[model samples]
Structure formats: C-alpha cells, structure tokens
Target: MIHQIRIDNFKSLVDFEIGLSRFSCLVGLNGAGKSTVLQALDFISQQMRGDIDSWLEQRQWEPRDLGSKLTAKQNVDISVQVETEKHGLIEWSASFNRQSLRCTTEEAFCDGVRLLKVEDAEFWIDRSVKQGSLRDVRSEIMFEYQGSILSQLKRKQIGEPLQALKEVLANIRSLDLLSPEHLRQRTRDSAGHLGLGGQKLSAYLHEQGSEVRQRLLEKLQHAYPQLASIDTRSLRSGWKHLDIAEQFSGKVLSTPARHVNDGLLRLLAVLSQLASDEHFLLFDEIENGINPELVEFLVDALVESEHQVMVTTHSPVILNYLEDEVAKQGVIYLYKNAKGATQSIRLFEIPSLAEKLQFMGPGEAFIDTQLTELATEIQSLSAKGGKDVSAAKR
Candidate 1:
C-alpha cells in the first residue's frame, strides 16, 4: 500500500507531501487543490505505464504543462513510499524533464539499499546485496528511455524488491473520472480491471469468475434490495451487455444497463471496482449523484474494505457518518500557503479541532471552522525550510 507521497513542480502542488492511511478522505474548500492530490497519484501511475508524452496526451496537456506554473522549474518530481508484503518499505522518486518529455532521473531504495538509479541516458541496478555490501553483480543500461527506465526493465532481470515496487505502482487505480454515459455504453473489451471511467464495466464483469461475481451481486443487493441478480451476456455484435434482474411484486423485471438510474449505475460501478484486485482506489466528488442514505452505505463499505481508499467530498453527511477514530487519522485537509502552493495536514492536528470534535460531529466541526484560519495557524506553527511534520504524523 502507498504510505506517503511528495510532489514538486506539479501544477498547484509545489513541494507538497501527504501521508495516507488504509482509508483516507480529502476535504477542503474549492480551489484548495484537492483533486490535484488524486491527479498526482495518477501522474505517477501513468509514468510507470509509459512516457510523459503519452501521459500528457491522456490529460490533454502540453509538454510545458507538466511543471508547476507557480515556479519556473522545468522538471517535475514525484516521490512515493510504499509498503510491500515481501520487500517491506520501498521509496522511489523520479524527475520528469518538461522539454525532453522524458524521465531525466530515477532512483529507488529498499531497506536503505539502492536498487535502481538512472541519470541522463545511463542507468545502474544493484542486483543483490550481501552483508550490507553491494554485490559485484551490477547491470548497466545506456539509453534514453521515454518515460521511466525502471518500468522498462524486464521482470526477469530485476530482483524481487524492484518487482514488488513495480507491481504496487501498476495497481494504483483512479476512478476520479467515472462517466455515466460511458457506463451505459456496451463494449467488446473484457478488461481485467474496470476502465478509468468504468466504460468497460460490462466487459470487466464478463471476465470475473463465478465466485467473484456472486460476491459482487450480494454486495450490490445491500444497496439495491430489489436487485435479484446481475447477468452479463455477449451480444451479436461481439459486445458485452450488463443487465439487472429486479424482483417486483413476485415477478422479475430485467433492466438493461442503459436504463439504470444514474445513482444505481454509479453505485454498481463503485462496488465492482472495490471488489477488483487493484491495491489503491481514488474517488473524486464521491457524493455527486448518490442519495444520502446510499452515501452512508458507501462510506461504511469503504471503511470495511481492505484496499487503500482515498476520496474527496463536499458532503458534510459523508463526514458525519465516519466513526471518530477513523476521522481522527483518515481525514486530511488541503490548503494553500501564502505562496499559493498546496499544503496538507491532518484535520485532527488543527489546534482545538480535536476538542471541538468531542462535542460535535466531524462534519459540524468542519463546517463551523474556517480552513483559512486553520491554515494560517499551521503555517506559523511550522518553521521555514523545515520538513512538514504534520504530514509525518501518520
């Protein structure tokens, strides 16, 4: 799971860092750079998959658009710390050159040992370490890779630590752009995971095993008690379609995906992604179309799930539903410093906020307090040119 992230020269985020829990929620006023937090994670995932140029295309951004506008820096840097079952803790950082649209530098370390390092067109990897000494076995690659040299390395050539890091980065999934129109469309692709917008949800369901599908249906029934069963079938055009069987007055009524309500379809999409094999999930504006009661249910489900989940919300109801313990550590507040760069701190760390939480719901406390005032208090408490200790609290 991802433990922490630090980003520099990336849009509104300049020297920004935030720690994450198993289930976290980002809350802040508009333009506080909440969505950019999710985008940073997606940016890292895109870098791992391919070159910077391709990622810019996905976001419809230009080469120069990658850097933070607040500064003249031409390179965007992102660092991630992840905890793996086999490798323990691994820290990886990469620098992307805006002009070249390629990774200028990349480095990774496991247990304080360098696993991979790249500078310019050359790269080095320490294949193994014994007795705290680097082994004589080292591999060198001299070439200019488009995106990440670490990602380009063959799995057979790298050891288990590097492999585990790659897997974690590859599994970082973002659903910040789920579209109802795409969810209603029928597609022929049977992707192992749901597409970013859930466009291939039908195809994805088609690929799930029987046991997995059964588990998904049971979970969905919790939100839609009338949903008797879910079925997917191959169409004549080779596309797959998803249909729902609803029990009505002792009879069954089948409804196609296109006819499903916005809230129900969105809920189904969320549930399906939760059941997927992805390690991390990011949701933006999680309360968009869902009812309050269903939003409560979604929150409960997210907390109960094992995956690392992060969501941004404007709904106070979402906060009110969270248990005190979860809110204490899982809620992160994003704000802007006097320099207009994004800054983050746990909501519980705000002075007197913890005391207020004891008397009021987290939602009420958030609504009553002014985030700007809180941000000012934090800025004064923290020293200049110092590490953000608030981010390290997690």
Candidate 2:
C-alpha cells in the first residue's frame, strides 16, 4: 500500500508531497490539479511496467510534456513509499530525463537502509544481510538499458526487498474517466483485468467465480432494486459480452450491454474495481453518472474495501457521507498557490475549515465555503500573527 507520494516537476505539482491513507478522497475545483496527481501516479506505474515510450506514444505526449512549465528543471522526479508485510516500509524514487523520456536514476530504501541505486547508467543492487542492514553493493554497469533499471533487471538477480518494491509499483491500476461507451464494447476472452477505461469489463466479469459474482449482485441490488442479475456470454468470434437482467412487477427484462443505463454501467465499474487484484486503485470523478442517493453506498464500499484506494470528486454529497474519523485523515484538499503551483493539505489542517468542521459536517462546510477566498483570508491572518500559515501551506 502506498502511504505517501512526492512528485517534482510534473505538471503543476512542483516539489509537491501528499500523505495517503488506506482510502483517500481528493476534492478540489476543476483545474486544481486533482487529475494531475492521478496522471503522475499513472506515469510512475507505466515506467515500472517496462517501456515508457509506448505510454508516451499512447497519449501523444512529447518527452518534454512530462515536466512542469513552472520550473526549468530538465529532469522529473517521482517517489512513493509503500508498506509491505515482508519488507516493512520501503521508499522508491525514480528520476526521468525530460528530453530522452527514460529513467536516469532510480533508488530504493527500506527502513532507512539503501537497497538499490542506479545512476549515470551504472546500477548497484544491495544484497544486504538483513532487512535494515548496511548496504552491500553488488555493482554492475549497463549502458544500453531503456525505461527503469528495476524493470530491466531479472527477478533472479534482485533481492527480496527490491523484488517486493517492483511488484508493488507494477500493480498500480488507474480507473480514471471511465466511459460508458468503452465499457459496452466486447473484448477478447483472455482479458482478466478491467481495462483502464472499463472497456474490457465483459471479459473480466466472465472470469470471476460464483462467490464474487454473488457479492457483486448484492452490492448492485442495494442501490438498484430493479437489478435482478448480471451474466456474461461468449461471442462466436472469441469475444465476450455482458447481459443484465432487471425485474419489475415480477416481470423479468433482459438487456444487453449496449442497452444498459449509464448509471448502472458506471456503478458496476466502480464495484468491480474493489474486487480486483490490484494493490492500489485510482478513481477520478467517481460521482459522475451516479445518483445522489447512491453516493452513500459508494463511499461506504470504498471505505470498507481492503485495497488502497484514491478517489477524486467535486461532489459535496460524497463528502457528506464520510465518517468523522475517516474525514479527518482521508480527505485531502488541493489548490493552486499564488505562484500557480499545486499545493495539498489535509482537510482538517485548514484553519478556516477546521473551525467550521467543529460545528458542521465536511460537506456542509465545503459547500458553504469558497476555497480561493479562504486561501486569501488565511494569508492575511498569517501576516497578522493570528494563525500559523505553514500548517496549511504544505
């Protein structure tokens, strides 16, 4: 599970850092860098998966597009801290050259001991005696590697700590901006994971066991009383499709994927993600196409999920459903500073909001406040020695 992230020179996130909980909700206005945070995480996941060039090509982004325009830095840095059962707390960082779109340096540290380091195209793997022991450099120099050094190494060569770190990074799944049209398409029979846009949901649903399918049905029924059942069918062309059955007045109605409502399809995508095998999940605008009454179910399911999840939303109803304890730690507010750099602070850390939280729910306070105006007030109060601004600045 990722406990924290540090992104430097990536879009508007210059020297930015945010701590994460098992479940987090990122709330902010549009263009406030909420989506950019997910993009940064996605970029790191892509780098760890192998070829960075293919990811760039898929997005039609230039190598220089990775860096922020606010800084003249030639390199972009992305780092994450993950807590693993076997390795404890492991911190991994990768530096990429903006012009080449390749990893220039990468390093890992577990509980303060350096386990892996790669610099100047020369890499070293430490086969230390124990988990927190001193670094033992098993050095090697490779000049012709692409993407990340960790991705290029064989599992046989790396120690347990490095192997665990790679696995955690490679397993990140971003389900951002899911489209209903994409979700309705038939996919190959071998598709096991929901495609980033939920395009392969039919094939992935076909592979689930009966227990998991039953759990999904229960979840859907709670929000959608008409939903009777959901199943998959095979196409003659070796593709798979989804069929949903809804009951009304004791009459069963069968519908194909192409005919399902937008809300139902989006809800299915959201619930199916909670049952996925990915260790970390990123969801953007989760409230989109979901009814206000069902927002509670979505928030509750996400909180109870075992996987580490990060969600972004502009809906006040979503915030209203969070429990007080969870809202205190898991709710993050993102805003752009006067310099146009993205800044993040926990929701409770804001002096203006903290005062109101005592008297109201997060959603009530959020709906009643204007963030940019509150930012200006905080700045004025800081100048007058009224409150410590540093707490909210970070």
Model 1 per-residue lDDT tens digits across residues 1-394: 9999988998999988898999999998899988898888888887777666755775688877767889988888989999988778999999987776667888889889888777745666776532243444344565556667766777776677888888788778888878789788899975576666778888888778557778888988888889888788888988999998899899999999999888888888888888878889998988888988888899998888888999999878888989988998899988888889988889877766787898999988888887768876777667663645466335
**Candidate that scores best on TM-score:** 1
Candidate 2 structure, TM-score to reference: 0.92
Clash count in backbone of candidate 2? 0
Those runs of model 2 whose alpha carbons end farther than 4 Å from true positions after fitting are 129-146, 189-191, 209-211, 378-394
What is the Cα-based TM-score of model 1? 0.93
For each candidate in turn, the TM-score is 0.93, 0.92
Which pairs clash inside model 1? Answer: none
Pick out the ten consecutive residues of candidate 2 with the lowest summed lDDT.
129-138
